[model samples]
Target chain A: MTNQEDQFYITKILEGDSSYYTHLVNRYKNLVYSIVLRMLKNEDDAHEVAQDVFVKVYTSLASFKGDAKFSTWIYKIAYHKCLDALKKKKRNFDTVSIDATYEIGIDQVENGLGQLETAERKEIINKAILSLKEDYAAILTLYYFEELSLKEITKVVGGTLDNVKIKLYRGRKMLFGILKKQLDPETLAIYERGTK
Target chain B: MKEEQNKEMEALSKKLFKEVELQSPDSNFEFKVMEQISSLPIPGSMAKYKAPFSKWVIPITIITLIGSILLILLFGTGNQYDIMSKLPSFNFEAISSPLQRIPKTVIFAMLALAVLLFAQIPILKVTFKNRWH
Candidate 1:
């Protein structure tokens, strides 16, 4: 939905019409879940955090004065909730280790070699993203995954514009190093093709 | 590190990063959230609205307002002419009769009740609908 349509439904929802919020949810669910999933790295945790974020948005709609885009604000809420969940799990400020023990046989990749390649590449990128400090991961996710501009990212991450830029520069470098080390050459070639 | 080389590397990293696929959520995820929200007590109902703090404030405000009105009425009865000279007056012909005076108190009470009811409405709907279900 367009921002204007979203604002209209948000107004309706805030006016004690909770049913209309489902429209807002349906529109943004995939994007919001994607961000939370990246940050949390656990499907169950991501789902819980995303839901909490929306419920928070529903409750706090009265206070949203359109000072920033609704997407930026909602993302900020989701980002913070994911961070909070990580903290609660005692997993904050540390990289999530990918357990080799959880790896299945090649039959698990029976869907296709293409999917297998993509999954292997994703594991590397996910590892890289998780390896970065929370602050850097947050800005990177906001910028790359959510496609938020620097100004909006500053607002979402509660940092200055220069801080966001500095983090983005450093975060990308750190992620690249991790990716090159973790992904095999064929997987990297496949990734390059998919991007182009 | 050379600046141009760093920029090129950053661009390549960004390009490679874009290849990361989205992790699909489990099918029953929305149901999990819905269940959680459904379990929460809805806001602004009688039990919450009638908390001791709000209950105290409502009655005290009404009493204070009524007291102020009585004081004004008593003082006006005693020194109506003098006070009329000293104070900026709203024309009392707009309120022609003593019978008309009673409605002012009723109006104040109604206004107070309206404010309370308005405050209570959100809480009521939030709480009641869930209970009814």
Candidate 2:
């Protein structure tokens, strides 16, 4: 969405018309919810966290300076909230090691996944993301899911662009190792086709 | 050996990263967020205009400060002569002497103290007066 349109909705919401938030919620709900679900690895926790994320965004909307995109700002909030929920649940993230059983399930999951096959890949991808160190996972989520440029990701994550690049490099390496365990040769071929 | 091996690994890594995409939530998700938000206390509910307690606190503090100063001035010092007169060697002349009646040192100290104390009253009153009707 354009900056001008965001400012318009902001003004309306600030003027005691909170229903204006529904438009923003509709626009980014999927993006926000996906990030939360991926990080928490539970639908119930993800749903609760997603609702809290939007409420926080609504309350803090007046402070939204246009320094970054609206999506970037909202994802920053969603990302933090999701991580907080994950910590509350006491999930582990010390070091990531992949299990080969994930490899066996790939063939079975591939046929049943249908159009959601990509989504199933996302679920596995989320496990990989959650296994990463907190700071590295944050950088990867902001970069890949939010589709933010390094400069924009720097502003959102409050890190130097060089740090963002280094973390992305490390995150991709770690993710590759994790995904290789879950992805069969067919999916790996499909992934290759996209890059080609 | 190292150069060819590194290039192949890079190709494989990028291939894996591209295979994943985001999964959308179940269809009922939006309705659930809406329901949750609706049940929350309305945003800005705490922002209603009212005279803050801090506003009243400022005046009350000023008044208490000034009142304590005035009470100290009124009651802090009393007649030393009256107490001293009860002593056997205390002469009526010593007690009733012109010097005793009004000491320049005492008068100067009282006047100076009163001037300083009274000086603060106007500034305090002016600040407190503005706070209320």
Candidate 3:
């Protein structure tokens, strides 16, 4: 729904027609769930945290001053709630060394991805995304999937614009690195066939 | 060449992410959230403004105790001690005379301490209430 429509429902709910909240919840559930799922990486934890995000949004709805888009506001809430859940579980996302030797050209990787069925290609990319550090995975999802601007993402993720840019840069590199490893043999086979 | 590759990767990422479907929560997710929201106090329905026990009770008790002490010191006649003398109790003169000789500064300090102690009750009550919420 449009932001105007969101404000309408928000007004209704604030006026005690709280059942209007169901519309807001339905509107943003998938978006909020997707971000929470990407960050938490556990269905059960994601489900619980997503519910907490909506409930918090409902309780704090009056404080939403319309200074930012409703989607960005909810995303900020979801992101922080995921961080809290991670801290509670003592789950850390420390940086790890990725194998750097598996680099392949983007064109070759693209050709390999094209050759796979849609579901298979999607699975490979999703798995690679899930394998990265949580911050990188979340940044990638927000940047690419949600199409939030770097400025908007900085607001949601709470970092300087340069910091977000760095994360986005590193996140994209790590994603490509992982994708290259998974698409290596397939791209090599395609290369061989092309050479023949 | 590096910049060109970066552009290609960006385009590729955009294309791939578009195909990534969002995962949905359980069908009852909205119902569950609404259930919890229903349990919450409605906005602007201010709870009844019942005064906290410490807010009124502590001050009243402190005032009564101080008032009773003042009344005995200011209004008690010499005959008030006649009842004690009849009981053949330990000499009240020793205690009463010594109490009167005690320094005014000391009396003021003790009264100040009592006031401070009573003051903290409401402060602590407020602090704990804030922490709980």
Weakest 10 consecutive residues of candidate 2 chain B by summed lDDT: B45-54
Candidate 1 local lDDT, B1-133, one digit each (tens):
3466457656665665587755556666556554555544432233445575465666766776677577557545532223323444656554444534454445446666766666566566657776554
Backbone collision tally, model 1: 1
lDDT of 3 by residue, A1-196 (tens): 5999999999987776778899999999998998888788889999999999999998788789999999899999999999899989998654434554445467667778888889999898887787778777778888887789999999999979999987887777777777777885966588669957
Q: Considering only N, C-alpha and C atoms within 3 Å, which residue pairs clash in candidate 2?
A: none
Could you tell me every candidate's TM-score relative to the true structure?
A: 0.62, 0.57, 0.71
Docking quality class, candidate 3:
acceptable
RMSD of each: 12.5, 13.2, 9.6
Candidate 2 per-residue lDDT, tens place, A31-136, comes to 7876776567667887788888988987777677777788889888987787778778888646554342323223233332332456676677667766766666
Instruction: Give the Cα error of residue B17 in candidate 2, in Å.
Output: 5.5
Global local distance difference test of model 2? 0.62
Task: Report the number of clashing residue pairs per model.
Answer: 1, 0, 0
Candidate ranking under TM-score, highest first, comes to 3, 1, 2
What TM-score does structure 3 among the candidates reach? 0.71
Candidate 1 residue pairs in backbone clash: B44-B123
